[model samples]
Target: MKKKDSNTIAQNRKAIHDYTILETVEAGMVLQGTEIKSIRNGRINLKDGFATIRNGEAYLHNVHISPYEQGNIFNHDPLRARKLLMKKKQIHSLIGETKNAGITLIPLKIYIKNGFAKVLIGVAKGKKQYDKREDLKRKDINREVERALKNR
Candidate 1:
């Protein structure tokens, strides 16, 4: 039997801290030769990146794929908008959901799956001040309970 390798590269921790993630979707990215090389070298960043529905299709913005050091002028732009490949129905559904006020499409992570680059996109809503405070309080309470259980 052969061991399977895990396929994670980088994650956007800030997205979880600032937004209430409601749903997640895996989508493929269209990449050029140098761009693929850069990603395989772990030269990518998804933090502060997001997706937008434009012309009935989804495009990722602010996701950086660093230039391949060995490549010449053909290297891809680091911060260029990359198109996300998804089914038409799925794109339409996400567009509808994003139409709701205060809802957003955030990039949660970028990883390699089945020899291709895939991005984990999250449908999220921004948290209000009170909601953030309440979440902190809940986390503190849970930590206290766990500490008490461990000492007992």
Candidate 2:
């Protein structure tokens, strides 16, 4: 038997700077054929995307998988909500945590693992303005130190 490698399709870069991710989990996506095709072609965007638990199930919103050009009327909607496959208990836990102030369920990235499309979702707390500034300061300091060392 051969081992299959995972390939990343898209990432949500803004999510990292905007939220302090507490935990991450892999979840399966319920996608249509056309949507999957579009994703495979690297036409997906998860920048403004998020996950929500509703009616005992989790759904992904704001994820855009560009319409597959060849499929006329059968092509799925680009920004349509997609269901996330997870255990019921997990869904309940996510709902409870998100009910707390400032906590949220955000999509971190979308990737193909062993030929299956999967989503990496994160439980995160929003960062304050000052927090972002502090992170930027630390990053700059580290860069300057590295440059100084390289020059020596």
Candidate 3:
């Protein structure tokens, strides 16, 4: 199997463990110069980030992109809400999905693709405690099976 590219800047592993992702969409971000510079330096965090569709637009919240060290006066806010660029049809579809109870838009990861910063958003459903436990058990079982096969 091939490994993921180094282009991935940040990932929200907690979001994956806490929510069941039903679908994923890639969206571009409208970032300031310093913000993009910081991202390229690996100074971004997606652990607490989430996406919201408001007034027919998608915005990302709680993602932190630290200010560039040399940016000085031009540095952007570290925790500011950033705009996400998506097609109108995609935004409308996300609006419908998010209106359903327990459904939400979560930022799964950020990566640089073809010189552009992209966010991978997941349409997710909240998982109950038992559901999380069950998922953990299933993962453990899969790992054990893989180990057994490797040793055979």
List the candidates' TM-scores in order: 0.91, 0.90, 0.96
Q: Flag regions of model 3 displaced more than 4 Å.
A: none
- The digit string of per-residue lDDT tens for model 2 on 40-69 reads 998999988989888898999999999997
lDDT of 3 by residue, 29-125 (tens): 9999789889999999998888988899999999999999998787898999899999999999999999999999999989999999999999999
TM-score of 3: 0.96
* Model 2 poorest ten-residue lDDT run: 1-10
* Residue-level error in angstroms, candidate 1, position 146: 2.0
Candidate 1 per-residue lDDT over residues 32-121, each given as its tens digit: 768988988899998879999999889999998899999998888899999999999889889889999999999998889889999989
For all candidates in order, the CA lDDT equals 0.90, 0.90, 0.93
Off by over 4 Å in 1: 1-5
lDDT of 2: 0.90
